[model samples]
Every structure is written in structure tokens, then in C-alpha cells.
Target: MTAPKPRGGDILAIAAQNKVNWSGLDQTCINAIRVLTIDAVQKANSGHCGLPMAMAPVGYLLYTRFMRHNPKNPEWFGRDRFVLSAGHGSMLLYSLLYLTGYDVSLDDIKQFRQLGSKTPGHPEYGVTEGVETTTGPLGQGFGNGVGMAIAAKHLEARFERDKSGLFDHRIFGICSDGDLMEGVASEAASIAGHLGLGNIIYIYDDNHVTIDGHTELSFDEDVCKRFDAYKWHTQVVEDANDLTALSKAIEKAIKETSRPSLIRVRSIIGYGSPHKQGTSAAHSNPLGVEEVKLTKEFYGYPTEPPFFVADDVLAHFHECVERGEDLEHAWNAKFAAYSKKNPAEAAEFQAALATDLPTGWDAELPVFTPKDSLATRVSASQAEAAIGKKVWNLFGGSADLNESTFTDVKDGGDFERGHFEGRNPHFGIREHGMCAILNGIAVHGGFIPYGSSFLCFTDYARPSIRLAAMMELQVVFVFTHDSIGVGEDGPTHEPIEHLSSLRAIPHLTVIRPGDANEAVEAWRTVMTHTHGPVLLALSRQKVPTLDRTKMAPASGVRRGAYVLTESAGRPPEIILIGSGSELSLVVDAKAKLEEKGKSVRVVSMPSENIFEKQDQDYRDSVLPPGIRRRLAVEAGAPMSWYRWVGLDGEIIGMTTFGASGKYEEVMKHFGFSVDNVVERALKLLAR
Candidate 1:
């Protein structure tokens, strides 16, 4: 059956017209999104369809009118960011990208929710053009948006001066009830509000329906009131179908320069669905052909058309491209004039846009010798301070652990609402926000960012860490008081599962440096590697520096695992493996083994993630395959060593939490001493 077509009209004419009189141009464009979403899900047989159908107009307005972005240059630094916090509505994002001349194609849209398609079930950061961040796990995108807003403020403060709006851009996000309900969002929203990030605006799709039926079933709270408590500017639109109201609300949001804005736009779930509108059934499964056809008909769309776009609708969207180009051109002209006036600042701006690290950055890393007895956290602080002096773009702060984590750079000023250009940021006691903010800073580019907190509190930062890994961002995480060696802090303050749990993450680099020298090497490794996020787990107590003359050079830390002490003979009968503070115990065990007429090799495996990246030849060179006799020691979980120690090997590590006692007493009680390591090694060797 052929679909009916309507005549052309102006925006006012279209808005005034009733459902029956509505033009095919308007209905076709909206229904195209509905049809493509349903078809894509039907093809892949997996995905949520309700969100795209309900929020199509929101996506349409942002893509066809407001956002200033170039699909051709998705990585354009000046482009506005769009984060889909409700990632289940990925089809909505994919469809918009396809129509807006982004890299996403018709074929990509059709292949949605399928393997190898750029349009994944959820928007992945690097995999898709125009996807600002990888968002799944509710509330993360909210935090990510805060990070982007913070970045915008920082950049504007640093680059935009005297009629040069170099970094004047907004960070917009589409959030849902689920996103707002997550605690991380609350944490991020508080910080964003406290910082007065006026450039960040979020459109809340207040669709009363959720996957488990009405949102009232699980979530029933005044969202506007919650945001208001965070000191954010809030607004409400009674109807999502009212485009004029949305446009006006967005304009108001943009105009506000004192606080972040949250425009609560009440929308019905499955807006066009004939029967499933405002129902949970419309949230995930595809509307059947009959239901979908009825939905199109209800929206005054052609009944049989699929992925069809009217000429006027195409022209309407083309306005966005033209407007964006004009904006970019105006900004470019302004920048040219600014460059003529401020030559040095312009050069710095260009260098930052290029994302180029300073030359000879490694030369600034602080080094330590055997005579030095310093905590790895202290070393990290010194190294970071030295690096910060050379790299002006480096910026970050701690989650109220600046003193304990030693993350504060000397002489760096705090980043405040009026002083975003300052280098240091005090994230207060919010760990989740700090991590999410770091991810934002890294994603914003031109700045190398790091966040710090006690290792035990990584649980609070885990969600952000996962998002950073998903985005493959280069944010550094400084986690101090790495283990039970935190002494009097008790089990609650000591981290046991953190190192292993962090190591389990696919793209995260978890490095637990043994001493001051290794800590310097670890920072160098972090500065050079851009694959993903890096976590530096440091000890609270001071550790003696390893003897480089008798042990492997600190540079070996880059290899992940290296031979710290080699056997004098052809090969050692037993191998001892350790990391961080435990390496000292293994070194002592090695000496004891040699005195007992046994040759032993001591290996330091600081970062299992980096070690795993090493070639088999290098791995075998460090831990020869022939030496089946091995013993692994670490203060944390024993489960992490089974891979390094083969079937016949033994691991001496804590299987449970430590007690409240002195660090030495806890180590002894947990059998983490040199005597236990030597005993375990002898047992393994005898076997």
C-alpha cells in the first residue's frame, strides 16, 4: 500500500496544522526514525526500541537545530558534545548521525545491534564518530557530561581572552530517570553545580514508564527538587511534543551563565505507538508490523514507507549544517584576529589542539637511589610536580586525599568557578565525581588529567574507571595506601581486592610500584602510554629503594615484569615473584635461598596489565618456562598469582582481610614475611 503525501508549508503552518492536515515531510522524517529503529532491532533481534520512538523529536531538534558540530570533522575540538546517557536509545543517536552527514551510513543504521557494525547496541566512544563518550551503566554519562562541562570551563578560562571565544562551546546531554537515580550522577551534579558550570545543559526525558513498568514502581522523587538542592538552575516543559517550548527552554538554558541547567521535558514513552504508549511494553521489544504501521498512521505518516525522507525535511536539517559552518567560520575569523594580537598564546592554543606532550617530558621524572627511603606516594607527588612544571596542560586533583595520596603538585593553584585556568582541582570528598571529571578532562583533550583517592575507596570510583576504560581514555588514577600496610586504618581503610579487581578490567593498566625509583618509572610509563587509563597503586609506608647495581634497572618497569635479581648459576631451581612492597620480602627470600645452596631468581611484576602486553619471548625470558618451581608473594589476594605460578607452584598471599594492628604484626600474622616466602619457595623447589 502506498503512503499518503502532504503539501509543503512553513514552520508556523506546520505547527498550527492538525494531525490529519500535517505534511508528509514532517511525519516522514519522524517515522523514518521509528521504522529504522524497529527494523534494526528486528534484524539484530536484540535492542530497545521504545526510547528511540519516544525521544526522536528531542534528538531531531538537537541535531537539526541546536548543536554546532561538523560530522566531517568529528574530532573537531571546538565541536559541541552530545552524550546519550540513556544509551539504550543508541538507535536514536545512530539515525541522527546517519542523516547529519556523519560517518554513520544507511547501511550502518540498517546493521544496528549487529556484530561489526559501527552502530553498536550501545554507543561506544572511539568506535563511532560523533559518539562523545562510551555510555552504558546508567548515570555515568551524567558524570561524563559534568567532566565535559568542567573541561569547557577550563579551556575557556585558559584560551578565551579579550574578544577571542576560542573555547566557547556547550556540553549537552540526554538523560533519563535511570540516569538521575544513580548515585554517581548526584555526585557529579553536585560538583558541577558547586563549580557553576553554566555551559552544561541536560534534557531530562521524563517518560513515566521504565522497563519494569511505571517509574513510580521503583523511582518516585521530585527530580527538579533534587537538582535544585545541588544548586542547579532548573526548568520544566509540560509537553515533549511542544517543540517551541523545548527550543525556548534550551535557549534559556544556554543563556544561563551562573549554574548548570536541567530542563525537565515531560515526554510520553512510545509517543506514537497506538496502544503501547506510556507502557513498559514499549520500552524494549520492537513494536510489531501492525503496531508500527498504526503508530506511523497515528503520527500522520505514510503507512508503508521505510527509511523514507522528504525533501523539505532534508532541507530543514541542512539548515543545521549551514548554521554550524557559519558559526565555525565566525569563530575562525575571531581566532585569526586574536592570533595577530596574541602570538604566543595562539601558538600554545595550536599546540594544545594538536595534543602534543612537551618534548623531553621524561627528563623531568624524579629519580631515587638505595639511600632514599621514601613512600611511593611521596615519589609520585615529586615526579608529578616536576612533570607539571614542564607540561602546563597537565591538570588534576584528589578526592580529599591530596595529603595522603601525595597527588598535589607543588605551587599549583586550585581550580575554582572564577579560576578554572588554575592547575589544581580540589574535588572535595567525592571520589566518583573526581574520577568521572578526570575522564571528562582527558576526553576534552589538550590536558593530561589525573585523580587520586585512597585505594580502598576505589569502589566509589569503579564506575568512572569502567567508563574511562570503555572510552579508552588516558586519565591517570592515583590510589594510595595500596594495601593492609595502611596499618591503623583497619580493614575498612585497606584495599585487598582492589589491585586484582582493577587488573581484571580489560583496558586498565594497574601498576603497584615497589619503591621510589619504580614509582618514577611508573609515571614515565603512564606519560608515554595512551592506550587507556592507568592506575598507580602506591604504598602509604616508606620502602627502601632497590639496589639498581644488583637488581634490574627501574626502566624494566615498562616490561610489566622483569628479573630484579638473577641467579649466579646457569638457571635458578626456584623463582620468587612479588610486586610493590612484597618485592622486598622476595629479595630477602632470594638471599636466604642462596645461603642454603639454592639458586633463586627474584622477579618484580609491578603491572600485570603491561606484563600481559609483552611478547611471549620477553615473558619467557623473564620467567623461563623450564623453571616450573615457583612461589608468588603479595599482600593482597592469592587468586591473582595462579596464572604466573603454574599448576605446581605455590602462592603466599592473604586469602582474607587483615587485622587491626601494626603493619609488621599484620604482615607476620598474614604469613607475608620473608620467612614464609622462603619456606614456600623451598617447599615448591623440593616438589
Candidate 2:
């Protein structure tokens, strides 16, 4: 049986006890987190107050009692990572960060949800010192935590190579009821369990209240049972307010060391406010000024002082700064000893930890000639395989499409329970889960994670990809079957608008490599460019590798767009532009146009994003302002080509969903044919 809910006197007695056994400090810190959340929400007049308010005890226990994180150096490799998967309740994370003596200040908290403030509406990765990943779309953080746990396991597997206890930290996450309800979380949870990621521990805030009303109106499944089905170690803390049970549950979870653990804590939605407590009203929206005052009095807090943080509470939390520094220092010393014993492993470990790859890491990337048969996906796989061999930190997998996507690092061990040394992760068929997991891997550091699936499946994973772009994570996304060439499977599998849609997301580098050599260069660019995630759109059908000797070398793919074949004359009358599968089509048409005495320039524009980043002079030199007459060809949507073709030019592209046919027939059925392109270019030249 669980302890009964404490009455007013019992609560006060618990709070007033200063004895070391039940020292009031823990309660004070917990209450401090609750009050800070309430005050910040009221000030913002727009925020989720219920979760932070209710889960304060669990959050307090995890931060003060369990996690080994350095507030002074948030990037310490040895630190235990904490992800707030229930990111709408960002105040929960912000309050902990501020209380723990991170760079987040009282002023930052005061400016919550304001412009130019570190405390945004959601937990953003780079903007806040302690925020691990950007999460607001419900379950991305939960999936991300799974990725982090997997990364930790991979690190131990690859480097530890023994029963040595170095790199023994875990990943902790605070998730909401809504987080568990999201499909991404379910997908990630199942994989984590299947892989037996013992380092993952998630505390589900089982408030049982959704936005519409009671979860009974919609969500009513035994979450613990569901997790058990997924093969996870599970527990339920009967009371959200019970600190001792929470601590014990977490400690037990840490000891299991075989399966991921899920501790579901039942709690009131809004704890303190008399009117809103345990209701959906408390879930979002701020308590009124009067309700705020009433809530403070109810929690035994001073109503006069808003955002008040107690000194003893502050001191207690600040100890984390010192504790973290000590942990990192000790780990550093151990690493030094480890380095002395195993110099090669130590060097590899340090290099992985550092974001930069070794000099000339891409020196061995394949350079293809025309003789290298239809080689888009195959070439990408070759380049990635070479990278997987050299970089200890390079790790990733496909979303059940490894064979088709060509993303499997050949012979790179498959990551699973009891096999941590493997570099490849089996994310299963969960594209959404796979991408979010990659986000977790990226944010966790020490690894450059990539994920692959059919280009059409980007729809399933767009939310996580958006978060990756928003956080500017260095995740490489390998998307194959860039066009209607997916064939046979018909319209559903073919990606028409995916290219335009992905290109529009800010900070995302979308590169549709045209052939084998461009695919190699695209991977090279992804390694050197660390600002954001790079999306590589590879061809499903074989695209002939344009011989580098006769045309511009594929190395120009890094420039985004390059003049592959120039007109017989200096200033070409017309320019032919293409990306991915269509570049070969453009090249074929360039031959036809050249035969017709039309001086044409063929430009292989792999990445519009990178090309746009080029200086105007460089851009003009490649696309030239003098040539208004241009023909752009792409098997996908023509929206992105408008800028290059100008208002007067034409785009030989798909006008409808592709017909079910062979890849060649599909390309021909759509006007991507050579005759159509030559006919279009002749008209453009005449105009």
C-alpha cells in the first residue's frame, strides 16, 4: 500500500522538519521548482505549468540525487545526459538549470518566453547551456534519449573493449503522458528494449490528463503493460509527491544493467492551485493572479515574493557544480591512465569526442568514371563505408531500408544488447523513430550519426528532421530513390514534392547528388560541414557516372552547383541544369542540343542549399546573369527550379503522380525524355 496524501498539517510538519533524517531541504528544493514554474507561467501568461509543478519532486530527485552532470562544463563527455522529452513544460528544465548553477540566470528565467531570452517557450538545444536537445513536438525528446543511450552503449562497446568501468554513465529523461502517446516514442521504446539498452531510464509523468480533458476521454491503456510488451523493465511510483520511492525506483533501475527501465509516476496535473490542481485547466494556461496567490499560500510559500528561490535550496543545488567538476576531473585522470595503457584506443576516443575528423579522412573516397555502371546508391554506400572504417565515432543505420538505401556500413557490427561494439544501429521500420534517435545520438556527442530511408518516407520523419535542423545537429540523412525512379511501387512510394518541401526547411542542407562521383563528394561535404544536418538524396536507378576526364569533376558538388559541360562558345546561349537522376537526362539532352548547333552548358547542381551559400560572384560565374534562356530538368517537383530558370524559362518535370511502370518507362512517361528536353531547349534558345 502507498502512503496516504498528506493533509495541511502533515505537509507543514514535513516542510518544517530540519532534522538531517528528513531534512526540509529536499522538500524546499522541490517546492522551489514548483513555485518557480508557476510564477514563470503566470508572468508569460502563456505556458504549460502543470507538468513542472507536479513532477518537481522527480526532477529534483534526478538532478540532486542521481545524475552526474557538470553545470560548469555542460559538454563534459562523462556527464550523464538529461533530456526533457515533455519539452512544452520547458520551465521544468529551465528551473533545474538555473537552480543547478548553470549559466542560465535568474534574469533569464524572469524573461521566460520573451524575445532575446534563453528561456524560450520550448527547450532549445544551442540557446540554453544545459538543454540537451530541442523538443516540443511531443515525443522527439523521448526518442532522442533512446538514441543517447544507444550511443553510450556503442561508445562502451567500441572503446572499453573490456570489463573496465570507464564510461559508465546513463541517460535519464522526464517524459509526459503525451510523450508516451506519440508513435515516435513507442517506436523508439520498442527498439531500445529490443537492443536491451540498460542505460536508458525514462520517468513517465502519468498525469492522466490530456488537452481536451481527462485521458479517460481518449488515452486509457496500461502504459506499463505496453512497455512490458516492448520488453522493458518497468515500475510505477504510486505517488508523484513521494521522493523516497522515486529515489529507490531510480536506484533499482540503475542496478538492473540489462534492459531499459520505465518508471511511471502517477501525479496531479496541477498540484498546488486549489481550483486547477489535477485538471486539464492546469495543464496549459497560467493560473490567474488570485489563483497564483492562493496556490502560493496552499504550498506554504511567501505570496509576496514571486520567483523566490530559497538560499538553502540554492546552496544544495549549487553543490552539483562542484560535484560535476570533481566527477569530470576524476574521469579525466582515469582517461589519462587509460591513455597510457592503451594509446591507440585513447587517441581514437579523444578524436571521436572532438567533433572534427582527422585530416584527410576523406582521402580514400571513391572517384568513379563512366565505366562504373549505374552508380548512385552504390557509390554513396562505398563512400559511407570508407568513412565508417576510418572514423570511430561514425555510426548509423537505415529504417528497415539498409539494403535499398545502401546505408549499412559493411561488416560494421550491428548495435544490440550484449553487442555494444557494433557501429550500425538497427532502427527497424520506424523512420520517425530512427530520425529522432539520430537527433539524440547527435546531441549526445562523440558520434556523427546518420539515418536512411526511401525519400518518400521523409514525410514520416519530417518532425524530427525539423528539430535536427532547428538545433543545427551534424546528423547526415541518407534518403535514396530521389524520384519517380522508385518505380513498380507506384505513386505512394515515389517522392514528388519531397525535394521542394525539404529544401524549404531552414538550416537543413538538402543535397541531391546526381551520380556516383557526386555522391562521394556529397558525403565529403557532409563530413566537413558541421553547421547542420545534411540530407543526401541518392538515386534508386543506376545513374551513369559522368567520366571526370571529359566533364567537370564531381568534386564541384561541394560548391552546390557546378558547370559540368560548357557550351562550345565562351558564353553559352542556353544553360541546362539538373540534380540527382535528372542530371544524366540533362547530360543526354546537352549532347542532342550540341548536335543541333546550340551552344549549351550542362550544370550538375547537387545541393541548392550549398550553392545558395556561395558568394554572388561565384554563383553568377556558374549560372551567369547573361543567360536568361535556361532549361531546368528534374524528375521531382519543379518548384525549386523556378529561380534558376527565371520567369521566361521552362521546366521539363513531373506534372502529376508517376504511373506504375518500369524505372525507364516512368522517366519517359513524365517528359524527362531527351527529345522533350532538346525540344524545350530549342524553344528557350529561340526566346
Question: Which prediction has the highest TM-score against the true structure?
Answer: 2
List clash counts for every candidate, in order. 0, 0
Instruction: Residues 523-552, candidate 1: write the lDDT tens digits.
Output: 888887787999999998888898888787
lDDT (tens digit, per residue) of candidate 2 on 241-290: 77777888999999978999999987777777777876788889999899
Where does candidate 2 stray beyond 4 Å?
Answer: 1-21, 161-164
- Clashing pairs in model 1, backbone N/Cα/C closer than 3 A: none
Looking at candidate 1, what is the lDDT of residue 600?
89
- lDDT score, candidate 1: 0.82
**Candidate topping lDDT:** 2
User: Model 2 misses residue 522 by how many Å?
Assistant: 1.1
lDDT of each: 0.82, 0.86
